[model samples]
Target: MIAKVMRGQDTLGLLRYLYGPGRANEHTDPHLVAAWRALGVPDPGRDPDADLSVLARRLDRFVRPEVRRHVWHCAVRVAPTDRPLTDTEWDHVARKIAAAGGVAPLGDDRGCRWVALRHDGAESHHIHLLATLARQDDTNPDIHNDALRLRDACRALEDALGLRPTSASNNTSAPSPTRGETEKAHRQGLDRPSRAVLERLARRAAVASRTEQEFLDAVRSTGALVRLRETGQGGPAAGYALALPGDTAPDGGPVWFSGTALAPDLSLPRVRDRFAGAPAAPAPLPAAGPWGQAATAVGELSEHWDGAGQGVRAAGAAALGDVLTAAAVAAPSHVRQVLQGADRDWSHAGRPPVGTARAAVAVRMREAARALSAAAPKGQAPVGELAVRQALQALAGAAEQVTAWYRSCSWEPQERSARLAAEALRAAVGGDGAQPTLNFTM
Candidate 1:
């Protein structure tokens, strides 16, 4: 549940807008009002534009009348772009709500709410609950806090209605009235890794090109453990799996990080495994300062790296050049895709529309071709189809590097930065004195 509180200027109107579509429970149904009246919940529909802060006080009015009613207001959302709730799923949310101490079946009309509403032209569904409190008045207020309470409520409702794992996190910080546990269990919450910290580590894993040993070393640097379980049980350690460092503090000791090669076994595969079951990834850490940008760029290019001009071709060079150039910038990945698509179209039809970025690259390739041709005797310039094709490929690659350097003006993400320093150091040593000698002084 990604919880965010937006400050709407009109509380009543916002509440109405959120809950009062043609499919709204309070609109087409009569018993919903009766249920609220019977339960002692406030008449939220009365003043459509009332300030909610003031209404919070008036909530006591509802608590005054209905003996069965208690306050429970939370927003449960779904990424409807994916799957709709199946028949089995409906049963799950209901069961979960019941387990979390919610009584009574949330009527059929209410269940239909899941299929309702469009938010910002995207299909979105939300659950607006009006239910009585299952716990007595003596329940701790900390248990009522939004962070812990809403998650617990969501998990319980989801499990009851078959919405298990609909979300990624099962945040258990709230005091479960059902658990009957206390301070020690609550203290366990500290061991949980925050999304921010996990994201930072994941991003590192995403770009890192380390081998298994180096990869495990980096995970340990982040204070995690890797342990492998055999046959998914403690019968024997099948392999190593990484766990949050302090998670074992309660039971005994920390575990080792046995790197599991999931993807291409590149740096990023390690990061991907950490967030395997999560719905959305955490935000990337802000590239620190200027040096941080260089470091991050280097990190992205590390391992098996050669000069940017090499034949393998660089990823994101189009995008990279756009950022550092005097020319109008466009997204490199998008530009590259569009050009290839356009080329395919041209092959099938006529010349396709090529954007500025593609046009520039094409021009550079042509120039490189002319230079290579001139270097050869005019008519004798490589004329074989195979020779011509290789020459063209090399020409285009040379143009990519030359122009990228022209665009960046100074630093490049790859080996150029180190080479530049080496060049200056060599120059300082005079024309023939670049090499160091054992007897030389600084």
Candidate 2:
């Protein structure tokens, strides 16, 4: 399940969109599944004579005029694989989430006015929750950390209702795509959101380069427009933003995303630390080749995972992400697609726990990344099957170690990512030079 929260000041505008056809004419039979009062509230979708203005005015009646953003909206969606829930079940889910969000508590007559709407169109499984912030008693409801609370409620409901379990809220995970982003991707015929594509390209660029300039150049080489942010008038670059060539904004300009927006570790300061902590000279490349060397290094870390401290383990996890990114860039076309998927999953798995200091163990893994980057084919050079197999075997082991490490920490998000990466790696190995069919959806 996924829940997104949005605050606004326009109740009428929101209601119009909710009851009427969606941006893509996707809303059909948009009826109220639940509301604060079961009997009196006017439902525009269900009643032929009901109007959007009438419904909006009723919801806003309790809200004070001084309250700038009195409208609270939350969208809840179930996983695609989950069984379809009836309108009654959806009403129950909405009530639970609304209570969790402090909008309308169960059995509280003084709670805020809210309604849950479900469409019987393309996206029939999910429902939209709309609530006025002011309660019936003319007091505002406590909404602090409401997003997190709603997430917890969703997790509990998943268990109670026999639905698919989702990852818990974590500061380290990348931000999920917004409704607009998802719609834009669908409109543009993109397989994933633009933010996701940019993040992957940024990760590859960050891992493949050793200097800030090189990072900038590598990012530009991928055809993304780059804008460097400096500290002062003429100071060195402090940060950067990226935008894809054809992806634009409502104002007919590029939609830029900063490095940190992509991921916490991708920030300029954190990226610089990756270079600062490494040895001055490049690590020696063995006669066995880059892939073989990376495999050996990964295997060594996996073997030592049990004895390593939290800092070392966290650093190793991050370093492993670098290895996967570099390898994806160097792999053949058929294998590259799967490697990219593995890299994406592993990215979420590799984030260090908050306050875990950087460790020196990552230096060795960074060396492996450097070697892979250096060994990437210039044109279409053939890669050895043995080398690819060895690398995949070692990566699978490392992913397993990551899975266990996250499981011990009881972090469901990273654990799931590591498990997915391990499965993809194993599948790739079993394919024997053929394209592996792996699900990349989150």
Candidate 3:
């Protein structure tokens, strides 16, 4: 579900386009679902024969008393689903629009006016809403952050309606375009105003590129200025920021957006995952050792995990335990015993404790959880995969929390132990045979 809010004046022109005949809504005759009239005005109550123009004109009067941009317009486009929406579902969506857009007053007799129209068009079915910002009492509902508010509303609706997921809709970090920015872009005839076009291009490049350098190059090719962010004590680039060279400020400084700020999918972490499992260039295979065996075992588990979905709920813990035991068989006797014990602890409580042996246990547990997640298969039964992924994530999160505790402890030996344990675990997990990071790629 995508909800776009555009605030402007000229309520009647929008009404004609929505209620009147046009290519965008020509096929959507009898489209008006519900109309909320200002208090003292007559209620239409889902009346198909209601004069939209008259209602619109009447609605406009309340806003006319206010000098601000009094017209509030929004379009809610639901992606195509396997099942068509019933009339009740359409009505529910209209309710969602009202509630989300603030057209529905907080109290009775607020006199706010609004109308919802369901449009079935060639491309997709959607709802168009036009509302008077000012209520019958000559006051306005707070619509200052309306675009972001509507986006959040759509996210809630997706979960409520069991609709398909969208990354941008789910993203909370991205700053949404304000009504003024949207209106300005429309006036200039820009297909996507503000950072939208740049965001789209960056996502495409991130998906197509094979390495960090390659991704940066691809973004640059689109005429975007790229800035790589370094991490690991200046070891390598770990993140990025991109900006359009053409979009600049008064002092000639280019406007920048972190990859994540543009869109969630274009975020550094997700984009890096796109090229996982396959490196930018050929690399040497890992040695045939215990870590290698563990990697191979995880890879096998990935293949079987999908088929086990039907029985996972009842048997998942036991199955993961079995896989963990098998994977650790080739390790040194002490390491194998540690791995087995960790798996048992995880199975029983889903988390291990931070104690004297916190370093040894937490590091291994974190790596194991990461390995399992990286090795999980993709491309089928997304809901099941998500369930499994959540389980793996819990294990990883628990370990990180425990590790943090160990680091903050008073004892010097414990902290040193943790650092050593972490280094050792990283070596074991980072070997070419595991390529743990690569496993998370789509």
Candidate 1: regions farther than 4 A off: 2-199, 228-240, 249-442
Return the TM-score for each candidate structure. 0.25, 0.73, 0.43
Cα lDDT tens digits for candidate 1, 208-257? 31233444566567675545355665453344455554544445975322
Positional deviation of residue 136's Cα in model 1 after best superposition, in angstroms:
26
Winner on lDDT between 1 and 2 is 2
TM-score of 1: 0.25
Could you tell me the TM-score of candidate 3?
Answer: 0.43
Residue 401, candidate 2: C-alpha displacement in angstroms: 1.9
Model 3 C-alpha lDDT per residue in residues 23-129, reported as the tens digit of each score? 43333543666667423343233455666567767777676654667787887776542134555676677666666667664344575677777766333467777
- Computed on alpha carbons, the lDDT of every model, listed in order, comes to 0.30, 0.81, 0.50
- With candidate 2 superimposed using the best TM-score fit, by how many Å does residue 294's alpha carbon deviate from the native? 1.7
Regarding lDDT, does 2 or 3 come out ahead? 2
Ranking by lDDT: 2, 3, 1
What are the per-residue Cα lDDT tens digits for candidate 2 across 43-141?
878789988888898999888878898899998987543577899999999999999999988889999999999965332368999999998997779
Tell how far residue 315 is off in model 2, in angstroms. 0.9
Name the top TM-score candidate: 2
